[model samples]
Target: MSGGKAITCPACGGKIEVRAAGFTVNLACQNCGSLLDVSLPEVVLIRRYKNAKDRFALEIGKRGTVFGQEWEVVGALRRKDQITIWQEFLLFNPYLGYRWLLVADGEWQFGTPLADRPQGDRNRVFWRGENFSRLGRDQPTSTTAVAGEFYWRVKAGDTANATLFQSGETILSREVSDGEENWTQLVPVDETEIENAFGLNRRSLPRRKAAQGLMQFKAAPGMEQDDLGRMFLLAMAISLFAAIAMALLAGPSTKTSSMIQVPVGGQIAPVKIGTITVRRPWQFVTIDADANRFENRWVDLEYNLVDRSSEQSIDAFGLVEHYAGTSSDGAWTEGSHHGDTMFGHVPRGTYDVYVSGSAHGWPVDPAVTDAWGSTETINLTIEASTGAMSWGMWWTLVFALFAWPVSILWWRFRDK
Candidate 1:
């Protein structure tokens, strides 16, 4: 049952039902479409909507149960933005206050006015610990039509600025004017639920026509979605073939190894390894070092590759160590006995390799002695190789190929 009051429209002498009673401030004459102020004891004319043709799915005073709550449709407004037009139905329950049902693009959403402001700047906001990104700049919106009863003095051609932020299915909308600001939280409502609740015929419901111009994309003449898909596949195939060919052409590798002995607490002179010849214009050189069965000792090695022609040195470094001891958790071992380093973009050249290193014992073991009495020494082997290609370059090529098609898709459907 509607807890409403019936009044006479002073402009057209039509009987109007004020559904919200004490809360309703303005109402439209259903017969003459004259705006009337209902807040005062006597109704006063505000404006006349010339040639008004009301086309609404739910009439004023219609009762519906939504979200398990009984609500009456008290008012309705047809609003428009720069791109499209939609309708908003004002719902009222004596105990639950006011809510909104927004219809756009043949879809529906239930809106609840937010009491607390969301946290963030205009570009982004956080609500309930979730982040929302702003959809676009503020849009200018105008009320083009009004019907039934409303709490505020609503009239046609009323304007405001609206901004929207969205995270997944939830949307936050802010509408501001010089005098007032309002925020609403909106969530999608199923069409079936709405139809059952309002006794609506889905086939008779009015749907806004699809928007045109730049909002939608069309394929170029003689090109279809299938053609674009084939082109994308061909581009990927070409990149794949090029990557495989580069990998197969890395050629054979040249290896050179040498062993060196370092006295504890002292440095060893640089040792010369065999020369490396690069057959490719550019390649990567790898150095490997191993110190075996050495406990609590570390050796640091520096490598220098001097080109035979220009004497330009390309330098690199490596470290190898092995330590074992007993702790609260039984025996524990740390550090590696072997390490490797790689140098890239070494231009074509015949280079002579030199290796120098230093050795140190952990905790400064003073009583330690080796076969060379009173002098503890650790022996380590160093190896160098040439002509290997980098995996980094291969992955980079693959990324570029896939990114091209993705960028094209984004450009075409950005507005949609």
Candidate 2:
């Protein structure tokens, strides 16, 4: 590899080569871990650290064709947020200027700095006619390690505020520092492509010791990483099929329906609707009551299911009300004219169903009359079903099935 200039490390008296001589401003000593500012004729030491030797996938002066352009790896940085650490490589070409290669979360991305700033607020931004929405919150990032050369002055412990916005597969990153604000567009690149370009052997690459230590702990039995995904997917498929079957076979199959007239002046007497036999061990019993087109009036319905063999009784209630009036905001209506009550897990038996209810006026429950000043009667339609399925139970089962896999995924993401 050839470079425009070379210098000696001020702290360790070791040789340092500057690949981008005139444009390169700062660099870290590969031998002594000392940060140096080489923008002037004389070399000035910025910082010194104990840890110097760090392994990188790509080394300085290594030239590769990335995205059809030959770029030389000029610098590398190891940065970290509160939770995870990642690596960044600065690639440069004399004709194309500079580009960035980022490796994090077992993924690789290529970044290009935008000459024109994006337009919009922090939450959303528009660049080149594409809208990008922000993901997560702004995070503080610290440069934990530095190597090779950079165009701008950089040192270990340099901090910046970073925010990421995404539009489809492309990501836009904004980093604000004390001196300047920079925007870079990042697009995901395949790991194989990166490996092929940089002549990297991924299998033999050194792993982060801290991450390896965390992976040493064994996972719970039956909850192995390989089986978790398969189990979750299988369970989801079963749940979906069960849902479709229930939608097709489950009966709210109406057993009986009747229209009963109730005088507004008095309480309604119990009327025997019919008997419904439940063959299943347990099922939901539903009662639907509707008072059609009745305004400013309500009907309260009570149901009684008396078991023939056990002589046991189960009671349920429902209400049907509707009110309409004109307000400052124009005509408005509230409350439904129809309502239903469901009794879940009813034991299998023959039950004689009885319906009784009362009707009254809204706001003021006085005796309503007809044109001749006679008591008015409101008609209500009551329906009964023995085969009502419990949707809540189905959803609860699905959630319980999905919980294990989702929890495991969350844990891995958080600790990664």
Candidate 3:
């Protein structure tokens, strides 16, 4: 009323007024329904806003592989709407070339057209499927200057596409224009049109009936009827096959050997058990005699030996001594050191044991003496000889055996 003249509805030819608060001119004619469009001045304001936000400001640099191809981010553009930030990035790739206005929002919406395709058609295809099929011909780049509430708060380097719409028509219907810019329109559909589009028929198709039909068609719990029985049978068969295969492939039950005797307070009984090679000055035995006598006896021992460090054998030489005592010294002792070799019979008492040995030999410098040396001091409890599947050893073997099957299954089902 104050500045712009009244606009007439294109469909009804009714005179419409431009309200101060709203940018669109709403026309309601008796012949035709309500029609709305932005006036020429409003179009100018919208262009100004879009232009202001397009000014290059910030620079972004990033590199990563997306969808198998390498993509590099060269620059970034942004537009503001109150607290919301609409961003677009300039991306480059060896395969895809340059792409501008890669639309992205806080809501995680992303769409882009092939670089070779027309920009206008690309934008149209993103929102509404490809238009060439429906329109029968390639639509020309939309040139109609749009208006309405399409203002974007501008910052330097922001190149976001501001959507402009008039009535129910999407004015910007293409991804790229002749001038190489993608735009979109945000047209609002009238209440009647929305209802019709959603297949709503007021008196004929009652809302209650429609809701009931929808509920009836909704997916039920459990599996789909089409293949439910077959899938369940297959699952049962698979479980049965797994059980049978495991039973067949499992090794024979390990035979438990009787515990061999280790004589206590005798010449160190020499026994070549496993890979350990011991030369006890008393009797040169790999077994600990004093530790075997009392269930929990701590024996002090000194040994100078060589450890075999091979791919198959990781030899560890130690006195498997245990003890139970309040004081370290007063518990027990038969300290006997005969010619550089020390041997002692100790009761349940904490006694120190030492082992000095070389594992492997110096590779780089052969002259380097005793380069590979390892020592492990452990405190153990000598329990009564109980015959059980050494849980630790059995678990280690189980883990090794199942590793291959577990890895294969993981690889097969990882994506699903």
- Cα lDDT tens digits, model 3, 44-124, are 211222121222221233344444454444434443422233344444554465443322221222234333432333223
Model 1, 59-98: lDDT tens digits are 7677888898998888989888756688889999988899
- Model 1 per-residue lDDT at 82: 59
lDDT of 3: 0.31
lDDT of each: 0.81, 0.81, 0.31
TM-score (C-alpha, index-matched) for candidate 2: 0.50
What's the true lDDT of residue 354 in model 2? 89
Query: Please, what are the lDDT tens digits per residue for candidate 2 over residues 110-133?
Result: 999999999999779999999998
Better of 2 and 3 by lDDT: 2
Off by over 4 Å in 3: 1-240, 257-416
TM per model? 0.51, 0.50, 0.19
Off by over 4 Å in 2: 201-416
Inter-residue clash pairs, candidate 1: none
- Model 1 gets an lDDT of 0.81
* Decreasing lDDT order of the candidates: 1, 2, 3
